[model samples]
Target: MKKTVVVGMSGGVDSAVAAATLVEQGYHVQGVTLQTWEPEDNATTSKKWQERGCCKIGLARFVAQRLSIPHQVLDIRERFRSAVVEDFIGGYSAGLTPNPCVRCNERVKFGCLMEAARDLGADYVATGHYARLLSGGTRGPHLHKGGDPRKDQSYFLYRLSRAWLPRILFPVGGLRKEDVWPKAEAIGLPADEVKESQEICFVTKG
Candidate 1:
């Protein structure tokens, strides 16, 4: 029987390629995009939000369709606001610098996606994060730096529960950033149409 994996697709090239690669590997892949924030009703604000780093539901669905896999959006806006956004504000107000990405990864992204995976009877939860997992060791699965040093995302994943390590997958972790683009292009994804955003999804530029 093929193992089922619920992939967190962020509508970006890396995630699109991740889902495609897993499907090619014969896993039953389901693409899921987390709606972590509420966009403003205005068209200009909505357009700006879409240009950010997260919640590209339309593009995510398109990628899923191209891969011939199932896709769905999981709304976790309230949870994100409380766990990540509010926490970020609190931290800043307290004179501490907080990395919202790290908090989101730990409290919202992996946490919520893992729950969804279980509800779907999935064997594992996967993401496009550029980090590697090393297993078969005396200490069990350990998270390691991805193959691409420049794009390594292990730092953002440090807060993940150790127990969930074995059930998590990083499909694009071994590929370099440049290599990921070619894979995205090969899969017929609109590589040029999607630009990678470096800013926080909920925080707009002034």
Candidate 2:
């Protein structure tokens, strides 16, 4: 039987290609988008929210449909607000800078997504994060920098629980950023329509 994986789709080219790569590798892939926040009433805020790569639920669904795989949304807004947003606010208020992305990766992405994967009877949880995992030593799986130095995301994931390492997968870790676009386009992912965003999903810029 094929191993089952629940991929965290951010509705961006990287994640879309990640799921597609795993599918081609013969894994039973299920796409999951984490709803971390709700759009505000302000038109500007709503529009900005939709433009973010991470908040594109509609695009994620479209990618999943194109892949002919199951897709679902997991709402974790309350948790995100408490763990990441509140922490960020409190940190700044206290004259300290806190990185919400790191906290989210530790508390929500790996923590919550791992649980969701288990609930779905998935053998592993995957993401488009540009990081690599090396296994086979007595120490178990080790997280390393992705092959693409420009896109390496290992720093953001440094705080992930070591216990989750072996069960995690980064399908696009070895692919170059430039190479991913072609793969996305090849798989009918509407590559031209998808724009990359560096902004935080829950935070809107002025």
Count of backbone clashes, every candidate in sequence: 0, 0
Assess each prediction's global lDDT (C-alpha) against the native: 0.88, 0.86
Model 2 lDDT tens row, 1-206: 99999999888888999999999999999999888876433445324325763557777777899999999998888988899989999998999988888899998778887988989999999999999998859989898999999999999999999999999999999989999999999888776667777776667668
Window of ten residues with lowest summed lDDT in model 2 = 40-49
The CA lDDT at 91 in model 1 is: 97
Task: Give the lDDT of residue 176 in candidate 1.
Answer: 97
- Provide the lowest-lDDT 10-residue window in model 1: 40-49
Per residue, candidate 1 scores C-alpha lDDT tens digits across 71-154 of 999889999999999999999999999999999998999998999898999999999999999985788999999999999999
Q: Each prediction's TM-score against the native?
A: 0.93, 0.92
Best by TM-score: 1
Candidate 1 regions exceeding 4 Å error are 39-50
Model 2 whole-model lDDT (C-alpha atoms): 0.86
- Alpha-carbon runs more than 4 Å astray in model 2: 39-50
